[model samples]
Target: MGRYVRADGLDIWTEQVGTGPDVLLVGGLGDTVESWHFQLDGLADRYRLTAFDNRGAGRTAMPEDPVSIETMADDAAALLRALDIPSAHVAGFSGGSIISQELALRHPRLVRSLVLQSTWPVPDAYLRRWGLFIRWLAETAPAERTFLEGFYLDIYTPRAHNDGTVDRFIEDVLAFPHKQTTENLNRFLDAVLDHDTTNRLPDIDVPTLVLAGGRDSTSRPELGRAVADAIPGARFAVMEEEAHQPFQEIPDEWNARVDAFWRATQTRTT
Candidate 1:
């Protein structure tokens, strides 16, 4: 069931379902618990899944302070503490993946395992340029739908656009009642662009997996490879034909891959 829970001074919208080892899902920029609906449904039989809206998005109101990836990571830690989950497999996508890194670093004991999806240690020149365009569009787009279309181009593959999947997402963004404020959206992107954890990956000692969309332009394969290389034992894999949001595009396949990894971690611990 969905409800609000106080964590890190924010009344976060959180949900938990199923029964078993805990698995916490973290969404990227502009996402909510609804972002993990497929995982909640597909993997719930074997895992107790939890998800929440990050501060500045969805039902969680933006804090008066500027959006920072470290604070967002702290929020994740606080939510898990609030929920009484000592530790759980943590999976984060895109911006969420960045936040997950901080969570694992700042509160290592709170994360049983780490799954970084469409992640990067730091943006290379290519992503830096793209980030600039994203910020400009977010600040200047004529309409919400227009901004969403521009923002999604690099996030999903051409196939999704051709098949109407992206258009549907555009509609959903337009209709969402709790929209992210323009100020927060830009600040959120700042946190993403300014983030640098290339030096800290080796500090994370937990079981780690880094997933990349082979066709993704936002956080490309090379960036993901660099992240995996930095983390001592982190494994890296790519969905060759998939783009950034494969969890949304091909959720069953994504779920299966992550499930297997999570199980492997349990076996090693046992």
Candidate 2:
């Protein structure tokens, strides 16, 4: 059910399921197609959904060449073209949302609609410093779980940690075989560090929905508001109960929200 499609000079590992209007789901930093298991399972019956690994993550082997958000956007465009999809609804999480912005700007024809979750228009001073620190931590941390502990603390709410969600995820990461190398993680972070679409967001004329986690410190709600305000006619909302990952933590709620937006876009466009 999973396979590789050659795109942007490398074999991009991708998974496609169900049928109907196309939906491309892009994951956050270091995420693979597997990161979207909930969506692939929940929304596939109604929409054709495809998820893939970014250039420097997952089964898509990190290339020796430099990586950037712009190039990764190009990769997503190539993946759609290679799959014979003229255009589709595109949804992205965190870093993936940054790439989605670039994809919509660089290849506007390839994006029918955008669902940007936990996104920001650009990294502010605090966020830039945070990115640097995270990259440094990834490179110097003693153990994988050590870094993940810190990461989990920053991303998930206290409720998740207390409810055993964080513990279960740590175990899942530890048991996963396709561990992302620190080198690849740093590269991906570099791409995120360089992402800035503040000036260009207005150019994106497609139907766009920007969702923010009210408790997210990394990509704060203010940042999401700025992005929404910059983009012409884009709608913005907040999932107050979620932190960085509502789709994983509350799949049903997340799926219903995005599905409503996607179908509404289809209706208006058709």
For residues 1-270, write the lDDT of model 1, one tens digit per residue: 889999867899999999999999999888899889899999999999999998888888888887789999999999999999999999999999999999999999999999999999988888889988988898899998888888888999999999999998788777889888877777888899899998988999999999999999889989999989999899999999999999999999999999999999999998
lDDT (Cα, tens digit) per residue for candidate 2, span 46-75:
999999988767788888878999989899
Q: For model 2, state the Cα shift of residue 175 in Å.
A: 1.7
Least accurate stretch of 10 residues (summed lDDT) in model 1?
181-190
In candidate 1, position 65 carries an lDDT of 84
How many angstroms is residue 66 displaced in model 1 relative to the true structure, after the best TM-score fit?
A: 3.0
Model 2 clash pairs are none
Query: What's model 1's TM-score?
Result: 0.97
Q: Looking at model 2, which ten-residue stretch has the lowest summed lDDT? A: 56-65
Candidate 1 accuracy as lDDT: 0.92
lDDT agreement with native, every candidate:
0.92, 0.91
- Candidate 2 has a TM-score of 0.98
Off by over 4 Å in 1: none
